[model samples]
Target: MIISRESGFRHDTKRRGQSMPKRHPVNQTHNALEDEDSCAVYTALLADQGSTRSELRTKARLPLPVFTAAMEQLHRLGLVERDPSADERLLALPPATAMIRTCGDDLRYLAEKQERVYRVTASLSPYSRVYREMPSSGGITASGKRLLNRAEVGETLRDLTAGARGEILTSLPTGESEELFTLTENALRRGVRLRALYRSSVQFNQSSARDTQRLIRLGAEVRLVEDGFTEIVVIDRSAAVLPLRDDAEGALVVQDPHVVHFIVNAYSRAWAEGSAFPVRYRRQQVLEASDRTKHVIMKLLAEGAEVPTIAKRLAISPRTCQRHISEIMNRLGARNRFHAGYLVGQRGLVD
Candidate 1:
């Protein structure tokens, strides 16, 4: 059948012959047929078609009995078939489906074992413990257990102010009185770095202008931004306090690091993007003079004062009064008296 010599079929058959014992023909025959060498020879011979028994024996270099034993094993293993098309003298290879089926079974067994191991590991993980103990509510209360009153909150703030070596971030809005202003000034006089943000509209008032100037001289930074809410105060990076209500009675003292860090970041972003309060104050002061003059001229014009009457009342010439009215219309960006009054009201220039 043109079987290659390198297949080791011939050597295996010969080894079985040399190991056989005499006077035990039946036992020797069964043992030789069941041996590993016999199985190797059987597998090799099945791979070679059209091979005669004599030819197989000659190639395998084995005696008749050993060769017959190997051929019988090949028949038992179902690796060879008697080829009826060739006078039943030759052996044929088994179909490839059997070998592939065995390999697929082994792969499926390994995959099942791996899945079982993964399921067991996941069930025993530490995250499973956390999941079992979730939704807990026995920690600190909203009003802290240690500090229960305003007096305690004040003491804590005083300690924070004393320990504040660098800078402070605060938003102080003037309301019924200037209590916050006094507290801010006290901090400023202590040489503590202060960065303050106030509402833009009130920032130009006479009292606010003087207070802002004092803060600037004390090395405090100030800005004005569009206001929506009350105030936010962050002292150093260690602590933060926000009023729980708009009336500024009770405060929420934040000691959690993550929450305080987020508050500080929000304040820093607002400060950087905000307008300069001092510059807005200066512009308002400069514009007030022209605004007052425009108001006087508008009143006289409404009262039907002649040009000479207006000039005498304003202590200016008739031509100068007319020029002033023209300048006021241009400055107000108004087309008529109604539009001028609207613009003035919109600008919040009137008392």
Candidate 2:
């Protein structure tokens, strides 16, 4: 069963007497029979879409007949497309759009499946004269569960994002997904406030930079934190999705109000400290904060404060404080740490 933060929508796609329903196109392409060249072609195109027929055949390593068969099947399945307007026949499809559509289809299917399961389970239980009920946590409603695979986690995120109205908050760990970019872009267009935090390291990658720029242009408040963050998605402060465990392939979806509130608060604090990464505002916050720290450190150093004490005041390391002191001395053209202080007083840089 599923719990939607929007309207308490409970849905299930699992069937007790049968295997799980086949995935929609987004996932089915990955599970196609390996012996069929269709799977190979699909995977090749997935890695690099808009490949010419020749390029695709070379990448998939399939004979002409096999390649033709694969492309035909993929096109039929809606996982690939060949534009009639373009004669060159460079096949293409936006995988992110396909994923969003598949997610929507599966969600609707699951919602119906959930109702059917409850009917079946309740009917079987009523065979006993007295209504034997499952033990429950009663009014607590602190329910939580693990999404066992990437597909489940992705579906849940799609649902929460689709339903999000007030806001969507995210901490990106690996990088931005085109799928996520599409979702957030649509969300912003729909008038939902969006904010995201990522590691400072991502600002260097060309592709990541483009994606970040696109998100910011679409009205997302994007920022970068240095450390102590994890992947999290909070929707309208009503639900949260996070990894089930560290480096796990699973996710935990929480609807508990208190837990979601705490997670949102943590995100706010991190956002406040994050450095802006745009070309016009690259790392302004970190530099400004460093200047504030340096200002205090200079005053302390001029009073003959030891490295360890200055470090304590600035919440930095003794070695780091010593390095700062060294830089200060260099700036003042002083002979040593003691001389740096004398120069500071003479220059009237500090009171």
Candidate 3:
């Protein structure tokens, strides 16, 4: 006769069957094996019991052959019995109520220990050695992260320009824009040195009479260059603002010293070769001499006259000379003065 207890079974036979189930080696070994197999099957079932074969394949992250072999092994061991009432591929397990009850105290102990460890580690995190020595590169600094909205942008700019003692280098596509002029003037009044590069068109457009006059009166050093470079503003060789969006609504502020140095170097090179913004226009200008002012400008440019010198010889202000040159290149759809000259020569305008 076999009598069941809460923890184990008691058996009585004609022989000396007085031993407890816990002391029976054969029964203990079998129970241990079943427990081990049950744990594995339970975990897998919990992960994907109600899922389809395709879902199981994805969740298991195993190859098809390996997944099939695992399922077959589980079925043969009786750990996963088939669910005949449902789909043929579906399987189920007998309720593990008794086994789970036996391990409840041990599982609870482990869970409590894990929670304690997590709390202690989190409490000590700020003092960690790795965080203390964190390296700095190009990403946002702590201060920048705190100032993220439009309202704070002005404060950020003020802080950036506060102690800027060196020259600020900038390039403007539309130098005549009023906002840009105001910003430049503010920087100048703050005693910050200014070096600006403007597109050739802004130099000569008589339509922007007041803007040109104001720029000249401010005595802000200016230059005219022909290129597709967008607006670039570098402050004191330490920071730069480069527009990320087409309309200049978004910008990436670069605080990396190396990047700012590279940008400043490029700006200096362009400035060194660029013409200065002239104060006033003269009567006998190179631009006024020919009906095809663009062709004449390209011919002179190809002859290797510096932009400032060309402006002087042409009798117009240097800005006006640059504007004429820019127009010629655009009409010919040329990349630079040299290219414009080539196209003009092709048309027999210049030898």
Please provide TM-scores, in order, for all candidate models, with all chains considered together: 0.38, 0.41, 0.41
Q: Give the alpha carbon lDDT tens digit for every residue of 1-351 in model 1.
A: 234578735322134343312221123346643576566565556566677777777767667887787777655544566578887567655546433333455556557667978999898887656643442532234543234346655766666666776677787554212544555567778777788876554453577677777777777788765432246667777677776553344466677788888888888887886666554435655476445556767665555556686655544457766776777678888786556556666676545
Against the true structure, what is every candidate's RMSD?
26.0, 25.1, 20.0
Residues 230-274 of candidate 3: C-alpha lDDT, one tens digit per residue: 577777898886664433334567777777778888888888866
Clashes of 2: 0
- TM-score of model 1 relative to the true fold? 0.38
Model 2's C-alpha root-mean-square deviation from the true structure amounts to 25.1
- Tell me the number of clashing residue pairs for each predicted model: 1, 0, 2
The top-ranked prediction according to TM-score is 2
lDDT of 3 at 107: 62
The per-residue C-alpha lDDT of model 1 at residue 310 equals: 60
lDDT of each: 0.61, 0.72, 0.60
Residue 165 C-alpha lDDT in model 1: 67
Clashing pairs in 2: none
